[model samples]
Target: MKVLKFLSVLVVFAIIGFSYWIYSSLNAPHAHSKTNQYIQIPQGSSTGQILVKLAAEGILSSPLPLKVYLKITGSGNEMQAGEYLFDSPITPLEVLGELNNGRLRTVKLTIPEGFTRFDIAKRIAKQFPQNPPEGENAVLNLMEDISLIKDIAPEAKNLEGYMYPNTYDFQRTVTTRAILEKMVGEFKKIWKPEYADRALQLKMTPHKIITIASLIETESRLDEERAIVASVIYNRLSKGMPLGIDQTAVYIAKMENRWDGIIHKSDLESNSPYNTRKIVGLPPGPISSISESSIKAALYPATTNYIYYVLNVEKNDKSHRFYSTAAEFERGKAAYQAWLKKERR
Candidate 1:
C-alpha cells in the first residue's frame, strides 16, 4: 500500500510538471528575427505541415507544444491556409489563433470617387502589374469586357461607372479581372431594387442615372452641393441648354490619350459627344465612377430653376454659385474667372 501511494504521488507530480511545460510553451512569448515577414501557407496544407513550416520560419519556438495542445483540445483540423504576417514576440497560441481565423495578408487598393476608367487602369497597372509587365492600355482593355454588368446595364459600352469607387483589399496574386469583378460586384450590391423603381419613375435608365451621378461626383465634393448640381444638370437638360461642363472636355482629352493636365482650347472645341460643352444631354456613358451620394442626388434632385453654376470664389470652399438666368451666370462666371486668374498668379 505504501509503495502504491508513493507511485501515485510521483505520477501526480509528473502530470503537473508536464502540464506546466505545455502551458509555458503555448503561452510564453517568443522573440524572432523575422518580424513583418509574410508567410504563405498553400491550400490543402495539413495542420501538422503548417506547424512545421511555421516552426522552420521561427513563427513557432517549437511545434511540439502546439501539436500537443491541438491534440488535447481536438483543434488540429481548424488550421486554415492563407498568407500570414507574424510579428516578433508572438505566442504559439496567438499564432494558432491567427491561422485558425484565416487572417490573410492583403494588398489595399483605393479607387477614389470621380476616378475615370483611365485613372483606374493606370492605378491598377502601377500597383498590381502583370508578370509580363502589361501597360495601362492592357489593363484598360480588360475593362472593355462589359459582360460582367450586362444585366444591370445592357447599354453600357464598358465597365466605367459600374466599378464602385472604394478601398478594397485583395490577395497579392489577385488578377486584374478579379479585382474589376469585385468592384462591379460591389456596385451591384448598392444598386437596389428601389433605385431601379426610382429610375423608372424618372424615366431614366440605370446607365443614364450612373452617368448623371458620375458628372455630379466630378463637379462637387459637398453633400449639400450634389443635389443642387443635379438640379442644374436637370434644369439645363429640360431647357435644351448645353451642359458645358469642362470635365467632359477633360474626359474627351483622356479618351484621345492626350490629357495634358491642362484643358487646351482645342479640347473645349472637340466634337466628341462626351464634350458636354458641345453635347446637349448626358455623355454617351459615364465618364467617371459614381459614388452613392452622387447616385442619390441624381435620383432625387432638389427642385430649383437654376440652370447654371460657377465656382463660388467668395467662399473659397470648392462650392459653386447657381444662377437661373444668363446674366446671373455671366456675372458668376466673371467672378470665378477672376479668382482663377488670381490663384494662378
Candidate 2:
C-alpha cells in the first residue's frame, strides 16, 4: 500500500512539472538580432522545418518545448509561409499566430508630388537596393520602359508624369519593377474618363495635359493658384510666346545631368526642346511627376487674360503675382528681383 501511494504521488508531480515546462517555454518571450528585418519563409516548408529554422535564427531559444506543446495540442499544421517581421521579445505563441495568419512585412515608399524619375530612382536605390547594389542610373533605365503606359500616352517617351504621387506600401522583397508598375497603375486608376472628355474639349491630348500639369506642379506649390499659373501658360502659348518657365531650364539641366541646384544663363539658353525659354508651346514631354490637382488645373484653367507671373514677395507664401501687360509684369518682376537679391544677401 505504501509503495503504491509513493508511486502515484511521483507520477502526479512529474505530470505537473511537465505541464509547467510546456507553459513556460511556450509563453516566454524571446528576441533576436533579425527582429527588425524581414525573414522569408519559402513556400512548402514543413512546421518542423520552420521551428528548426526559427531556432537557428534565434527567434526560438529552443524548439523542443514548442514542438512538444504543438504535438500535445495537435497544432502547427496550419502555419502559412511568407515574409514575416517578428517583433522583439515575442513569445513563441505570438510567432505561431503570426505564421498562421501569414502577416507579411511591408515597407512604405512615398513619392512626393513633383519628384522626377531621377529623384525616384535615388529614393528606390536607397530604400530597396538590389542584392548586387543597383545604381541610380540602372533604376532610371527601368522608368524608360514606356510600354507600361503606351496605351494611355502612346507618344510618351518615358514615365515622367504618369507615376502617381502617393504613399505606397510594398513587401520588403518587392522588386523595383513591381513598385513602378504599382505607381503607374495608380496613375491609370485616377485618370478619370471625364478628364479624357475634358481633354478633348480643350483640343489637347492626355499627354499634353499631363505635360502641362507637370509644369504647373513644379511652378506652383499652392493648389489654389495652380489654375492661374495654368492660365498664364495657356495665354503664352495662345499668343505664340515662349513659356519662359525657369523650371523647364532646371529640368533641362537635370536631363543633361548637370543640375547644380541653380538655373544658370546657359541652362536658359539651352536649345533643348524641353527648355520652355527657347521653345514655344509645351515641352517635348513632362518635366516632372504630376499631381491630380495640377492635372485638374491643366484641364480646367481659370478664365483670365494673364500672360506673365512673378513670385509675390509681399505674400511670402511662394505665391505668384499675375500680370496681363508687360508693364505690369515688369513691375512684378522688379519686386521679385528685389526679393531675390535680399534673399541672396
Candidate 3:
C-alpha cells in the first residue's frame, strides 16, 4: 500500500514538471517564429526606440520579454547602430546578439553604363538625400567640385563622363559627395599614365577621349559594338566629317526637360556645343557616363574601314550593322524605320 502511494506521488510530480516545462518553452524569451527581414537602427536612435522598431517589425512579440531578456543578459548597454538583416523566426536572444555584435547588411547601388550626370544625380539623391537637394543647379554644382572631377577632366565643367558606372556598397548615412568621390576616385585609379600618352599619340586629349567614350556609351548597349561605334567616331574625325549623332540632341533636350518622345528638327538645330550633328568633330563635352569598355573602345578602335552604323532593326538589342557607304547606311535606316512602324502598330 505504501509503494502504491509513493508511485501515485511520483506520477503527480511528473505531470507537474512536464506542465512547467511546456509553459516555460512557450513563454521562453528566445522563442521566435517569423522569416527574413531588415531592421534599420537609425543613427541616434535610443535603445527604447530600437526595441520598439524591432517589436513593430515583428521580430519580437512583446517589448516586455525583450527588455527582461536584455536586462538579464546585460545586453542593454551593447546595442550598436547600423542596418541589420534578420532571418525569420529568430529569437529575441539572437537579435540581441546581432545588435550587440553590430552585424550590418551592405546596401548595393548599381550605376549602369551610359548614365548621364542627371541620371547619376537622381540616383544619388535617391540613395543619399542628406547632402543636397536634387535640383539641377545643386547637382551641377556638386559635380563641378574640382576635388571630384579634376583627376579625370580638369578642364571640364562637370563630372559628366568621369563618374564610373559600377555597383557600390554604402551605409545608410553615406553622403552624396562621398558617393561621387568614390566613383571618381575609382576612375582615377583606373586611368593609367600610359592612357594619357596614348591619347596624345592618337592626337586627342583625355577630355576628348572621354567625350568620344560618352558618345560610344550612348550609341550602343552591346559591349562588342562599342569599338565599332568608336571606329565611326574615329573615321569622322579622320575625314573631318561632322559626327551626326542624334543622342547628343536628345541629351541637350533632356537638360532643358524639353525632350518629347520624338526628336524635332529644331532639336537637331539647337546651338549647343553638344550638337554633334552641327559640330565638325567631337562634342564640346561628354554626352553621357562612359563605361570602361567604352573608354577602351575610344582609346583603341576596331580596325574596320566602316564609317557608318545603323541600329539592327530585327534584333533591336542595341547592336548595329556598320557600313562604309552612306547608301548602305540609308538602306539600314529604311529597314529600321519599317521596323519602328511595325512596332508602333
* Candidate whose TM-score is highest: 2
- Candidate 1 per-residue lDDT, tens place, 1-345, comes to 999999999999999999999999999999987786789999999878999999999888899999999999999888888888887899999998888899777889999999999999998888887523378988888898999989889999899999999999987788888899999999999999899889989999988999999999999999988999999999989989899889999999999999989999999999998988887888899989988999999999999999988888889899988999999999988988888898999
- Give the range where candidate 1 is weakest over 10 consecutive residues by summed lDDT: 126-135
User: In lDDT terms, which candidate is top?
Assistant: 1
| Tens digit of per-residue lDDT, candidate 3, span 1-345 | 999999999999998886675445335554344455467887788778888988887777766656755655676878998778776656666777888898766668789887888788877776666655555567667887766666556788778888888899987667677778898888887778888888999988899998998898888888988888899889888999989999999899988878776899999999898888888987778978777888889899988888888888778677889999999989998998898889899
Segments of candidate 2 deviating more than 4 angstroms: 1-12, 30-38, 131-133
Model 3 error, position 111 (Å): 1.5
What is the alpha-carbon lDDT for the whole of candidate 2?
0.90
Q: Which wins on lDDT, candidate 1 or candidate 3?
A: 1
In candidate 3, stretches whose alpha carbon ends up further than 4 angstroms from where it belongs are: 1-77, 84-89, 134-137, 314-317
Reference-based lDDT, each prediction: 0.91, 0.90, 0.80
Q: How close is candidate 2 to the true structure, as a TM-score?
A: 0.92
TM-score of each: 0.83, 0.92, 0.80
lDDT of 3: 0.80
lDDT of 1: 0.91
